[model samples]
Target chain A: MVQIPKTPGPSSPAPRPVPTSADVARLAGVSRATVSYVLNNTTSVRISEPTRRRVHEAAKELGYVPHAAARSLRAGHSRLVLMPAPDFPVGPLYSRFISELQWALGRLDYTVVQFGSVGLHGDEAVRAWAELRPVAVLVPGAGLGPQGVEVLKGSGARAVVTLGSEPVDGAHALLMDHEAVGHCAGSHLHDRGRRRIGVVVPREHGLESFSLPRLKGVRDALHGTTATLTELPLAYAEDSAARLAASWRDLDLDAVFAYNDEYAMLLMRALQDEGVRVPEEVAVIGADDLMLGRLLRPRLSTVHIELPSGRDLAELVDRAVRDPAAAPETHKVLGATVIHRDSS
Target chain B: MVQIPKTPGPSSPAPRPVPTSADVARLAGVSRATVSYVLNNTTSVRISEPTRRRVHEAAKELGYVPHAAARSLRAGHSRLVLMPAPDFPVGPLYSRFISELQWALGRLDYTVVQFGSVGLHGDEAVRAWAELRPVAVLVPGAGLGPQGVEVLKGSGARAVVTLGSEPVDGAHALLMDHEAVGHCAGSHLHDRGRRRIGVVVPREHGLESFSLPRLKGVRDALHGTTATLTELPLAYAEDSAARLAASWRDLDLDAVFAYNDEYAMLLMRALQDEGVRVPEEVAVIGADDLMLGRLLRPRLSTVHIELPSGRDLAELVDRAVRDPAAAPETHKVLGATVIHRDSS
Candidate 1:
């Protein structure tokens, strides 16, 4: 199959001209301004139905699609909600939340865009986002500062929202307190009379934001109790889990909070293979409460994390967009509870 | 936290003017052209290092980031790679592949954007994408037709690459033949002396694209054989699986191909709870060979799917972008094989 070359573009003698509004106007026997109003669906303008039909027909004939970026720049405002793609594997739960958010935003007549910001960080990421001139920006996982919020506002972002552990100044905050997850798991294990406890900290990159807060919460929960917390750094790899399980007895930890269910499953398999009996020898608990966790041999215990509905968040953003003068709202958007099972 | 009102915008007694190149030039004591040259890093035009530093500092002090859309419009080209965010859960395997592709593209200086085309279909989706005027597009999982490719090419997309079941008319193709997965599964089960087989088709939205092809492949595989195939409609819910398992004896199927590992795990659990023995009463197999499948009791057999390396696909795109006149190239990018475990 032969490709239509892009090199001999609008330059080199123009085999086919990229049609413009002016071309549509010429064909429709109307002004370029009229063509613009008709094509853009400008509710503010008044144009005859016949004129609109002619303009559309001419556009179809010329294969013209109005450039969204150019039109947005001209209007000085856009219906764009920009989200920076997380540089981490956020798991299935968070993935579903994002899909919901995108769907809800579309219903509100806003275009959702996930900008690739894999290597970008802090204010550098903010500057990159600002270049797009998105009307709203949703910064995930709490690194946006007051200055970052100010810079985005200066560049015409109507709403700056942050969804993370803590609220940033001058931004709508959806506080997803991850600490509760760790606390729930730690307390549950401690109540089961396990003295020495271990928490799995994944060595995967970009997880430090979630892992550190969770680790801190576990330490806090077991602080005054006789239970001692051990930080076991494990990579999300089979060999790493196997090696950790190999030395499980030497560590003398009676119970462990193995990060989330995926890690728990990996470590659980390794421990069973090593002939360590669960609950009796070493109680294990996980977070996320995946369905597969319940299907495990010991019926895995887990911390069920509840994230705020995406539709609720979208409505909040819509409210902010309508009245940007409204006070920045901070909402508690996370809930964590321990589900007891045979594993603990 | 008080929000800075967006209503009191540029039209209002401006709180702070969104700084432009002119503002940077005024601060740096240079022409707008010189400021543009310095800030945009135009190596074509030589400037003193001190002058470049002055321009950068001036831009920084004024908090100016050149509008990406506006600049691209003026240049008639951009280094933007656009991908439509799939409207379905593409699973962890594809998610990793996407992350890798994004990283590789970013390294090559192209800004990747995932356009939210959640509800749009056919030429409507293509029109929405073309409005952004991306230099390249990587479409996934079949259905992009010849006319759709033409529309995208007409609207300044240099390289149109479809990564799906079959090559499109003019787009460079990455053939992800999902049919092989079902063929492999069907053949394996039939080889194990199982004739009455039930193939699980997930009753999930946006899955028909992959599921239908795989089902066809299975039908083709057991065409002349004594094996009779039954289409099983299964939802991704525990109740749905339980209902199917409850009627398992009545259906009298000896084996099942449960869509993917997740579905297989769900069904297997229900079957076990219903007093049915795996690989005896009902043999089960899944696709996408997840690690969790290995950890399951009696183990789970699965079809291993191999995807083309993101780096390799990225290189292919780069080549097409460089030479759009070249003939469209099609590469088979998916490989499927059976991993025989205890379940089957």
Candidate 2:
């Protein structure tokens, strides 16, 4: 048994030193290159089964793990596929998709980093992200423009995929098409003989990308009809929702399309408190059919969005990064279907 | 005026890289070290005002952004403080706290990296974490043990703080004391003349740390009292909650202390749909007084827990890293108070 060193002096705590390939090599009675070859699973290395077993055992015993950044530096690129921070209030659908994406990336041996570029508005955010040297970046908002795309490309980012309504110049596009989500809700509400629709827009920063397009779709759907779109800017605060619900009669809206299930739930509860009967006084519709919505009394009607699987997206990013020169492609990653419930 | 190179060839898209400190130094007629010192704001540097201004101007003109990882490597520690993945069914309260912490950390010049260690059980998770060599690690769950603590300590992680109900053996403990959250809810229900109280225990894998302790606290609160305790193992899935709510009369529960606001919202909505009157038929209470709870009709009563601000925690970590021998202190980071609302 190899005896590890004792604890350090009282004055100074011993630094936990990571075991290198050399350390593993010494323990396995093999060369450093052999240890690296085995750990990295290099196909060219033709080693005996016993040797491979010895190397594996030594690594496990020594608690030797590969340094991700160091490996990335050596490889001239990282397997890290960074996703720009979700600029808006993320619902369960987005959360689950992100979680799944992380899992998928893990399976593909890529670390997924969520870079919160909140203060970074416009091209500056792209430039800052590029400096990180991520192989691929997935922007989930519309703030990224042509200059931003160029900045990312200039910094060794082989692939930049934007999940938004419009395609970013010089980058692969994964069109989420928020307009479609809005259209699904708008058309459904209109079909149910509801006019004078009130679309709730969040009064928070960074959500404009989603809200603007959705509002546009609502307007587009109501072009020929007598239905007029009213933009109700609502804060996430409970007091704000309560105030709005208290004056619900003054608005005289037949139906309201909340941004998502969260806002819908928020508004619905407030309306109930103010003695406003749902579906009778005001029909309510929301997007992202969250489970909590179904649990509500007179269940929340919603636009169920089926997002492209994160595993598939991760695989696509990997392929794109591996071969950047291969034809740039656009894919529709979000599909919306209206779920009729008691509320609408 | 410096002429920017047009975009590079297909094979090498980033030919003319952004100017480095050396280039900045050349432009400013100063040394590279001086440029670094000026940019980093090192007090030890003795540069005149004019020289500093010149260096700054040169850097600004050339768009010379400092490399984060290089600076970290040179300093022998990363600015990153890794937060271990929270258990599944991470509610809005935790989500908001994390978002706030990230914002606060950014303001303090610390980059927050969240490592999702879900499905990565025990020491393996710790090993996975050590790969990044974060200066500090904040474990938000109870799964990590003494061996895991040792692994982090051994890997140059200066401060290892565990935020959970119990004190972790070798690490600094930020005791959330989740049992107190349960007791707070139970005691409130008891005050409301609730004799038969049921507490929800989520059947999901990672939530055992939180759910079990909460159950114990509820049971402990009712000892020798007229109040009787019942354990309800409920999954986060809607079907499970709906099924449980449908057979409400069979359980004969007067009140329930759902683990958190998220679960409370889930179950309350389900119970309401099953024609159960809230606060009359089943007085429900939840922990983590989320904003949405207040928005609910007959607003959900909750145990509002004030966690130690992330800024304070971040400061503690920085201090601990600087002085490891500073007698390890366990901080009570989480405290519970019942926020009386319409639900109970």
Candidate 3:
């Protein structure tokens, strides 16, 4: 027999192959089934505390973690919660909201996976997501149709939740009444003796779904009042702001509801650069009550928004996933109020 | 034998279950292997064009999609590129960078999954991330040690990339060189004929990894010059900025380099609110050269940063995944150039 030369190194047995649950079971002097029950915490089967501890310790020593795919196959479901990434500029407030949601989902022992659905849309997008067979999917911003939801359900997705302006027929919906936000800002300006108001609609694509409704709301609020609304399309660029600022005198307006705090700040600086005074010359208001707003000279007045607590959303997802056949439900997840400050 | 009563449905048929690859193969009058090859675009299999067309048509008619988890298990790897969520606040610049990265990865047929690693750290964090069996894991900001990298590699991770100040022994590192950003800002301020320079260090958790080195760089540049450096620890809050503004008289700083555009904008507003003059009294400089900075009354001076293009990073990830045994590589991701504006 030929003796193969061993690689020269520390004679430690070539680092042990990735240990398995069977290795843990053998180390703990128990059956693999018992190890599974203990490690997975299957309450249906009774096991002694000492035995459970032993199984856990053995598994730890061997660095044996059950393969997620295999475990998912046994359970007939993956512990993945997919959230479609929003294809718009996510401000600090939205970022914080997502962070909270991810943290809450993690605590529930669910892996939150962000599905980047940037270019894909409608049924095609749903099919791509369904291929993953995630336990649940949270679709925000993009509107999902009935057929799209059906495809996901047929593909074994237990819970399908949609967050948008209104409810979809098949999936659970978290309605965000963005129009109310615009109405609040517009009304505040009207009451403050501003007759002509400019509503800044960002020129970026994908925001039309949001900005259109906001514009309609502003118009709705100023319907009976003597105030008039002007649509000012602005892109998030210095030249855009400067160009708008350059024509500030021609488009005479008493106040402006610049999309959000970021836009508001941008326009405010441009207006100031053009020697236009804030509040005194043109009252300004924004939304998403950011702290930077407060630091502004004439502290930015804004429409404050409140989103549903992350725990509540997480709980909803879990409940829906557990009883997938249950009738779908809808809830309002956004509320808005105005924060009157120096700017307005 | 007992007879079972069939539930009454429109007499035609009830809804069919999700169609499988086998169903497509049967409908196409081809083998399941042919269907798999056609659907997955497998290059190794030489199937005639007519057969491929038949399989695809059958699949579209039957609405069949190969399960992601099942396919991953069969292939012994997942097409997932996991990026751990950064613990620190993600500013506009970083957010844009990540967005670009995600889009690029998607074009390369990789799903970018952001793993929430807010609290988890070290080996525990690595194990948690490994449970999903992602093909590649990108750890940014967080410092991952050799042991953690080993754990990931042992768990079947093909590539591990770290973005930080320095390269880890095992993982591929994308060096940020943040200190250069500070040195550039400091030198620019010094050269602008400003005697005293104050560098703002945000006292937010998880920012120390970035802020500390920036402080060091400022100190390094001010070594021989007859100038002074003061570290101002400010939280991202109105009160913090207001307090800092109140004490601005005592600090007597002629120039300030706030962490980045966000912080610079915040502090500049606070300073203005406190009746401080800009450029004449205090020249404020920032980093990231945001559009908002340009719109400022006295345009903000910034250290313009250049991040590696998304395509470049995506190609690196692909290369590393293709050849896991290649010597680990390091890339300089961040470059800086000072844009002196009205503020300085």
Candidate 4:
């Protein structure tokens, strides 16, 4: 037999047992059922405000928090909305959308959690999520496939909603196609007669999910055209932008689609410093019509992406959760349009 | 009695029972104990690679997942490390730091989950987090007090850490003071022979945790100095910035600290369009020393902030988890200084 040491630690004296509703009831001089009624606000039973306050105070004094697991079991559902953390740092627009979504979910009494998905991939990531047993999941990006959705459902998920370019076979889809953003920018540049275009693709990890689709869209738009497309790998650093700017003349690109406004702002400033005149020498465009785009000297032309309101998305999630076996609904969530400015 | 109405969800037939290790064992033609030994990689007992593969395959085929709660009970600890989601959109530096931290935690076999904290506050937020039963928590900002820490510890949290201006009474602290950033920016503007300094305070909610401290820091820096500080409320919108710029001359501010690089870029561009020359007529400075600031024509001066590496912070969390009874340690995580450039 393996013997355990007695000196468990100096700071943690024989640990006290975790307090329960009975502890609160004892402290409050009430029955356990009465404590529960006051705490849970059993509307059918009339509990005086003073008694409710006494129960709450007793619970607080004991540092007692109702166990979510126990509550979930009793309620026949866990009000959990799980999402995978983005593989990389997203821009402000997407960030704002997420903030809105979280706020709306909170209003609907949902507990939203973003799971770290750094080392996991594809169906494996889905498996990791299934272990969490969330009532609903809202996934972003194309990594989740039909098989992944099946795994979630089999694990007792009431709802599996995805926001990506294409719909997963068994999941409700929030169809936000990044390709449209790129296609709009490409078509706008083409209509303006800017050929020999350079597309600035971010060299950041996880951005490939968005960048690759956008690249494909640009390729589709410029197909059978006179425009020559060049893919430029650029990191979001001054040194990377400077190196690209130094080699801009040799590449001889007449125009540039610099991913989004953030990148466009970075690359355009570098090009301007390199004495390359905007629109005259090399027209530049970006996606996401952020206010920063308008602040540029040669104002940045951009693809303004309008996403579905967060309230609307929250309602969609609630509906899906209510009827898990309902037909997988697909909603187009992208409104990508070109906003012309001086740079292009 | 309220009979909770039940409906068989349209597509969901009577659900199958959740698969167990015994089910995997049956499918793999092995005993349950043998399956456990193989699947859990019990080093004491060697199993053939083929048997291990068979066990894994069987587990996968059966869609079996080990219950985290059951496993936690067996192991005497859970793998959960909880964090409150940022109240609003944070800058890139913080986002990258979070990603790195999550990756590091995952490497240490901890599952990191960011809980949405939209409408919760102080002790209320701590109670909500405790209900989820995270083994460890890393909170940012001053929302958590010593009482909250006690509540968390009482609820079985192995570690409680805070990253904010000051240390809480009973929690490990990652002491990152925004006041230092503001002081640096404020002192730099003062030293540059600029007075009547205007500080841009974002009107956005949740930013008060950062912005309010920064504003106070500026005020603290110029307490006895000849320079006068004016607080300007601004939203992150073109219209808001343009309005601020239209009345810039009337405000008669010769210098400004526009919160951070993003806001600095916005306001500077607006001021330039409004015919207020940068540095010559009105100097501008920001914080976070973002690459975007340097990409500006008159390179933006900024407060360069050095944050502790994610690996280091992860180590802190790990150590605290291991020895929860140890004295709460405080570490400074801020290195804020001014980087002079053309704009200032």
Q: Which structure among the candidates has the greatest DockQ? A: 1
User: Alpha-carbon error at A278 in model 4, in Å?
Assistant: 1.7
Judged by DockQ cut-offs, the docking class of candidate 4 is acceptable
Candidate 4's residue-wise lDDT over A1-344, tens digit each? 11111232236443345678899999999999998788777899998888999999999888787767556645655888999987666788888888788889989989899999988898778888877778899998768888888787776678898988788888888877888888988888889998898899999877887898889888889999989999999998888998999999999998989999989988997898899999899989999888878888888999998988788888888887887767777777788889999999
**What is the C-alpha lDDT profile of model 2 across A152-213, one tens digit per residue?**
76556788888888997788778878898899899999999999899999988878888888
**Per-residue lDDT tens digits of candidate 3, residues B137-220?**
999986589888877777677889998988887788888888989999989989989989999999888899888888888788
TM-score of chain A by itself in each prediction: 0.92, 0.87, 0.89, 0.88
Kindly list the per-residue Cα lDDT of model 2 for residues B1-344, writing each as its tens digit: 11112222345343345466798999999999999899999998688999999999998777676665566656767766777667565666677667776676667666666775545678877877877767788888778888887777666677888888788777877877778888888889999999999999988877888888888888878878989998888888888888999888999999999998888988888898789999889999988888778877778899988877756766677767777655455777677899999999
User: Model 3 reaches what TM-score against the true structure?
Assistant: 0.90
Error of 3 at B135 (Å): 0.9
Give the winner by TM-score: 2 or 3: 3
Task: Provide DockQ values for all models, in the order shown.
Answer: 0.34, 0.22, 0.24, 0.30
Model 2 DockQ vs. reference: 0.22
The true-versus-predicted C-alpha distance at residue B188 of model 4, in Å, is 2.5
Better of 1 and 4 by TM-score: 1
- Regions of model 4 farther than 4 Å from truth: A1-16, A22-58, A73-77, A224-226, A247-252, B1-15, B21-58, B73-76, B223-225, B250-252
Clashing pairs in 4: none
Where is the poorest 10-residue window by lDDT in model 3 chain A?
A1-10
- Candidate 1 residue A321 Cα shift, in angstroms, is 3.5
Q: Residue A225's C-alpha lDDT in candidate 3?
A: 85
